[model samples]
Target: MRLTPDNDLTARAFARLDARLTRETERPVALALSGGGDSIALLRLATDWARARGRRVLALTIDHRLNVESGGWTAFAGEAARAAGANWRGLIWDGDKPQTGLTAAARAARHELIADAAREAGARVVLFAHTADDIAEADLMRAQGSTLGRVREWSPSPAWPQGRGLMLLRPLLGERRGVLRNWLAGQGADWIEDPANADPRFGRSRARQALAGAAPQAMDDARAQVGGRPTMDGEAMARVARDIGARTLAAALVCVGGGVTPPRGARLQGLTARLKAGEDFAATLCGARVEAASDGVRIMREAGELGRSGVVPLVLAPGVEAVWDGRFAFRAEQAGWSVVAARGRLASLSDADRAWINRLPAATRGAWPVLVRDAGLAPVLASEGIERRALVVERLRLALDETTHEDDLISATR
Candidate 1:
């Protein structure tokens, strides 16, 4: 491909993407195309790269259905993806929308929808078009007391089990928004400008306005020092240093608690302090129970929170897959399958299964999902035609592992 000044952006971005696709190069790559300048530019670049490599590109657009024009935007995204020679999938955020915290909720919904769509399409890496301008805006928001964390060049998808094995790549994070828009214009392409981006009511809009006419600042490459094991055993984390322990505990709580957001600020510090001081106590944070005992600290999902959160038994049909309670990814290969908590049914379990369940912490055993066929219960670990996989534990480990760098391939936790 010829590299004009405008087209050079595509070359550079493609190189970044190429570096990240060291593994899974044969798999179809997916991108989140929002009909915006950056994403449209990404679509073209990704399609070109995929085409040259004889790989396929899956472009996913999420319709949050928040604005009247969202349907039009999704259509635009689909058309853009098809024009770029990529397969397009439109996902809808159906049902009732939250009255408050709409932005956060919409973002969460977008991630979940995109992750599900990408996974369903057999793609493990999802490309995002976040640029330097986004990092600057995020920094401005954080300076103005927003709790947004720093955006990295590569990171795990934020959505739980649905995003279990997925990695998000921001190949254009080093590029500027204006440069990408110029490149798109050079190609005679157009994109939708969401009115919400300029609405002052949103923090991002206010930040964008505040940074108007200013050059985008370069972002630092600092990684979180958080570290943790892939299991729920508390003893493994007992002797960790204070600051590291606090960070690890936060990640552990979020993972084991099955919550997307990690606990922060004073409460987390207090809990870390107590644990560091060797205090034996039990507490709950982010829907996960944390117990610091003489045996060590054990963290598990708080079963009551599951009920309060309205999580129920998951029913799966043959050849269907679903995530249960944000923890396990369950796939049914047989006709009859349902996953329910193992709490009251422990006595009915086979002696061998019961023994295995007994080995786990008492608090965790009740919340463990057990497979059911008709009226009889089957051991999740030993069941036939039912593929049960724990998602959060290994994912959390990868997210918190210091050895896992941005360049490392985030293989599927399953």
Candidate 2:
């Protein structure tokens, strides 16, 4: 579509964004604002749209506090947002620089800080002012093999909100930078350029400057090919993170939640199905894409120590524990699988006995059924010791009860 050469184009853009608000965010929306010409124009047009629909908008700005003029820029942005009838807030970031390089570190801080403000405002959908030009620049940079190149189509950046919980979005990714500038000029608005934007020392500055100095028609030609396409960088990263996090959570629950340890001993073959079904991440803490063999889990860790590969035969029974390679290992559980096993009584084993069999991970500790013979315990799955295997039947029922208890807890907590 040919955008009109007037403020009406901005109005049209806002109209399109408004239509997407429900899908992008909860009813009301939060816009990442920076009082720059591009954002100012968006704010003006979005205010009109919000008013028309009886909707509300929150404008978020982040202050890195690196420059003397940062304070002034933040205040100005807040005033403009208020003028546009949108709620506004500026989040401050003042911390010692870690090991990351200057620009890389600052961009990471800014994006995460802005997301925090958006969450505080109760916004489910976050909108950023990155226009089409930004996408072209980013795509070109990635193609050129810059450090910011994405490893996968969707994977979380090392940014926050992974633990913080936020669904980031960018609908204006389709607009051209020139169109926004031209349209903002139509409305008699002005903007200040960050002095760093002209600094040639940084690659992004150099890239933006290159685009600015290029022939207008060359940029126009580039825009024709890159017309209004959205950047899936952030969104894609979020999707991968969800998958990884879920996989990790499921693996962990097997250790601590169920009244059972993961498969151990001769049954290491049994866990083959469980771990593989859960993405094989349970045994492969390295995030390996391939399936983890028995060697991987058997070499997880030795109690407080790390685990090693090779052949390690583990027996699951009373008064015994084993630490595999990583957090992944199975405890000897002949007792937990039997009936006479009491969870409270089983947990009180002596330290000397535990050290002799220390590889036991806690996830499987509760599931191993042993005869609660006075406080100290021993495995009880043999037919010779007991007159009947009624104890075995009891242990199976307890395992079912334990599974039910864990399911209830997960549903309640979730």
Candidate 3:
């Protein structure tokens, strides 16, 4: 907690991130600047690193607008970014705030906004300032019965199609909050402290207070091997049936289902057991339809379940891009375009296209997403000035491979 700028600290931070940055092309590096001590330190370090390499830096701040001070924070972030000789953008989470689960909702909004902004800015990697203290706090929360997941030093962006091709880098994961704040203080830098960090109603804040007087436990490096192809045919399913676990199956369901959350643990376990038994069966979980037939086990987004799950067609303006059903990323080149499930519209496709669509599993064809024009035009099939990619399936396939790093997954998608 010494108030002295440690050159070793800067060197260490740069060392941790240099290799990762070097692997990217000449595109600008993006950072999520929250105006907090951790993110401010990241901005400073990343700016220095980028400047030395003659690269540009883009700092993005999300104005959740939940607090009266949010606007000021975004302004502060802009000023800070400019002072650091970096470009700045302010994104707003402008919508109705939920009455409950506000923290989770805010986090989701933050990720989506940041991912969209970073991708739009031509950045393939976004930097975050998660420190060792945050990891300890998460561990404590999990110990207290919270189902928090582990945070890695590098990972793909959590937001779906918006974060499709973006990788998240956490260079400060080995650093501590106090050390970062001390370094910022020594540099004569100031930052805004969000009151929410200390709000006791939040689990993170409570965990922080509880750990104030305790030492953090050493975290384990063990990881569950939950890898599989995006879609497994009957032969492939049988090949991995003996090795497939509930965690792996659940991930497939979530990925193919185009849903964010995974299925309940107990139900997932039951389904895993049934699938392992190697019997022909059909089941739906978390908005995904999983069927095991003579053809194989095909898991796909349940188009009929979308309305019940509150997923609506995505409306896109000209020159705009969006992800529909969290499965496909679509870019609209013409005006008045939208994306919807292709259930009843299969007949509108050309004969050749219909033949190709018919070859796919019968249950999956209906749930396939297709682009449409407002003028009662022919069904678009990733051609004719429209671009569509199944990025979710690609990510799932990469994620299921145990050897694939999150960084490699992003690069592969790009």
Candidate 4:
């Protein structure tokens, strides 16, 4: 048997990922489709690559209900995928409402939906169509204060799953945006232009139109950093989330074991602002239940709510998929929530607590994550009579346990 250097390297990468995913799923590959020039080019490349290898491909597109041109893109993407001759599916989802700007929330919804869809289809590899130009522009956006940069996160395309431990791959991480567009044009591929992409009124729209194509100088700078920023903005944004009082919008309950998550309201508006401003940020966290104001770069928490005259009480039940605050149908999960609920304690304790608290940069220490919980504050575990959640889970769990015991005793007496 003769194996060359190239063969060995390729075999090693595929083998590592394949082994990791073997227990979870069996499908070969999945492509995230957007019906746009960049994504279409990626789809074509991946399909050709899969065909050459005699592998199956799964194509998935998330239709974010934000743009008026949304439905058109879904159909257009489906047809294009058909032309590419790959098994494809389109997921239509209600996008997150913006706390301040619409663009940031919508993109978060899109990526999350894509992740879930890929998992459901049992696809081993979830390929994203982000290009090198996207990476350069992302660096520029990160430098110039675009919040979407935080969510999309300047990582190279196909960021490997770090949170859920999913296997994600980005094949064209170093390919330039222009290269993809040129290739698509040559292939006579027609893609849709989301009208919203050009609207400067939206922060991301401005970044896409102005900075989507990076200059040579910026590209050089990003390369200087060596493969873009490795960190996603989820943790950073979560840190800067302002303390919206309980009356207006209940603080999002930490989902440690598995319970009910709370309402986010618009206090997250501040977190979005933090993403845009880079190091030091200033912005107001305005929602239906928050009233915070910032001074250009410094955030100050306060009290207030949007539409206060007749506030609609946001009442979400366990397991119900609904948009609370500006996010999507993100409820809580027992496994992940238990880990997330331990976020606050990471700071308070010493050595042992350090392991429990997910480590983030010092700059992002304060941002509390908006976790999804299953029931109403379930207990994952107890330690030294403490509930173990930032918001007291022991009290609730013990009370419930006591009530159950009493009921059982009464039944026995009867």
Candidate 5:
């Protein structure tokens, strides 16, 4: 079946995108446009949706600086967004580029840049143009021994600080790549195919090559789950008989774990099985410790991991906010302050500061970020803001419900 813009398929895609928007948000919505078929199609559809609702859309294109052609590609993306009647800007990932883990670093940088731009533009929600093909590729990667799990339709910004108070929406997961391209074709629009997509060096390209002839299916479990805290009820989880429910629980553990990535599927499965067995025990997986609480399983960041791992300290400018250790994002009142994880430095806590730090979960207390200036501890930041706050506290506050663990799973997976 051939798909075209204004056809039934496109209409359905538009409906799916519109349904996810609910009401106009308090702030503007932003779209990450890559000048690719999927994102350009999204730009066209989103601009119309925004226009009908009288809401503004900010189209942000990130130039990763990974390639010489990246600049030209971003300029094309900007033009596409403007043609679709949306405000557009290009963000460049400047500064040190790592030699190893370039792909992983670039992906993180892309999310960070887009999310930061969205925040700066006063947009609380940012939409991505990941299609069903992308989801299928993620599934393929998982099947090929990749540690990554299924990509959810809606999720929080995977990057900190920029991710704070921001929601990432993927509305095109229901649409196939061919269908989206068909829409762009009908509109006489074109897109650039990044060379990295076909390069054998990337796992994603290999996955795409493996599935070159396979048909990507529509995701059935596309319903949005309300965000909740990271904790889950042992009794409640024991009642979960469905495989999807268990996977959802696993995703929650990974989210709250504060790991750079979610744990492997087998590990998640084992954890789920242990939870369903109803045994009270404590275990660590993916940077989070899961222990049986009076009510259920309380999973929080593994404080021990913070001490072993060397985290990159962030330079905080005056009035600039950033996230540290996936737990907390804070702003400095003055410049020349550096935010670092407390870790072994907890011994430096004063009497007043220790009082507040004592209130946090023991396993995750050491993961908090503290400000330092001129080799002296910044006591005001530690006692007043940093100590009283948990890493996921801002995320929890932004969630639809402040209470409930299972209901607050941070994933947007169907």
Candidate 6:
């Protein structure tokens, strides 16, 4: 294998990325910068490239609020972006932090916040600075029984609007971390190291430590062996190629079911087998209930799991949009409304609505949030907002499915 000189890696990485950007007509692209070496390099390279092309790039730093230095880091990132002649914004993950699964929660929150910002800015794509070394680390982690999948060059933003159309592009996934840092050093640029990176408590930290002595594996193009994304066909599960189909289905279930992680391998395989057998069955896996009917199989959040998941009821104070159950994205008109499961109200709908409600599996009924105002049920579903929400949800599932091929490619290289 030939080596790319440290100085040329950045340009080479961008050259690879430029081909992917040909169809991007969005005025400004969003970059998620962490003030770390990889992201800083990306910010610099992207800024220069965007400027030459007369395109705008927005560099966003997320302050996860997990450490005291987070604010300082974000501020520094903002300054770096501005100095590089790019627009900058600092997003904060402000909310009640989860006591358990903090990393996963933080990741979800981070993407949601970033996607929201990108959408607000009219940008359809967000860039991340993950590198080849990160993929190696993830590979090591997976070998050690981690289910975390390969990082793809491009994916649908796991969050709302992006699930609709916003894309997450990782331009540096083919470049090595050391090469990026070397380039940064050559430019006399400095970066901040998060203490958590060396804390050893995190799996990532352990993987990083392991990489020090691990034999280097051939780093093939991270963007190879594309597979199909997940999708439901009418009432039946869509037929996808075996290997990719399972992965796409798993991703779709996890994304739609609001699970922090994908379903276990054995269970996923079993579900796929059942789907392929064309047998009638119903089972709950990874917070989602898969029901195989004569017409088709429907994958939805299990009603019982919703309450257990501790998804608090959201009150929309007019013109505000919120994601519920991590599955449904909703926006409501001005004030006096609370969104919760249809529950008992399923019986109160008009005959037509009743028929529609009855079509939903029993276990999935409570998974749908209905609007309530003025001591009565509000016409949320009647307003066709439910259809729009469903469209977004389906789009997100397709996005995950479309990216599953990339995941397959990454896995093959590993």
- TM-score for each of the candidates: 0.86, 0.53, 0.85, 0.48, 0.77, 0.80
- Give the winner by TM-score: 1 or 6: 1
Q: Over 4 Å off in model 1, which ranges? A: 1-8, 22-26, 222-224, 227-246, 307-310, 376-381, 401-414
Comparison by TM-score, 3 against 4, better one: 3
Q: Please list the C-alpha lDDT of all candidates, in the order they appear.
A: 0.77, 0.46, 0.75, 0.44, 0.68, 0.70
lDDT per residue for candidate 6 within 1-414, as digits (tens), equals: 223348677577667557556433556888999999889999888887786666789988889999998889999998999998989999889878999888878988888888878878977678899987788898989899987766777776766443445667888887777777778887898888889988899999999987874445666543343345445533212323333566667766776676546766788888888777777877888888777777656677788877777777777655655656665556666566666776656766567766776676678776677666654654344453322144424444444534432222111000
What is the overall TM-score of model 4 with all chains considered together?
Answer: 0.48
- Top of the candidates by lDDT: 1
In TM-score terms, candidate 1 sits at 0.86
Kindly give the number of clashing pairs for every candidate.
1, 31, 2, 21, 5, 9
Candidate 3 lDDT over 135-181, as tens digits, reads 89998888788766677776667787677767788899888787888
Candidate 2 Cα outliers beyond 4 Å, as residue runs: 1-8, 23-27, 98-100, 149-158, 162-165, 213-413
Candidates 1 and 4, the one with greater lDDT: 1
RMSD of each: 4.0, 15.6, 3.7, 15.3, 5.8, 5.8
Q: Which TM-score value belongs to model 6? A: 0.80
Model 3's alpha-carbon lDDT is: 0.75
Ranking according to lDDT, highest score first: 1, 3, 6, 5, 2, 4
Cα error, candidate 5, residue 120 (Å): 1.2
Candidate 5 Cα misplacement greater than 4 A, ranges: 1-6, 22-26, 95-101, 209-213, 222-257, 293-296, 311-317, 332-414
Worst 10 residues of 4 by lDDT: 405-414
Candidate 6, overall lDDT?
Answer: 0.70
Residue 336 lDDT in candidate 6: 64
Over 40-117, each residue of candidate 1 has an lDDT whose tens digit, in order, gives 989999888888767888999999888999999999999989988999999999999989998889999999999988
Candidate 5 positional error at 310, Å: 3.1
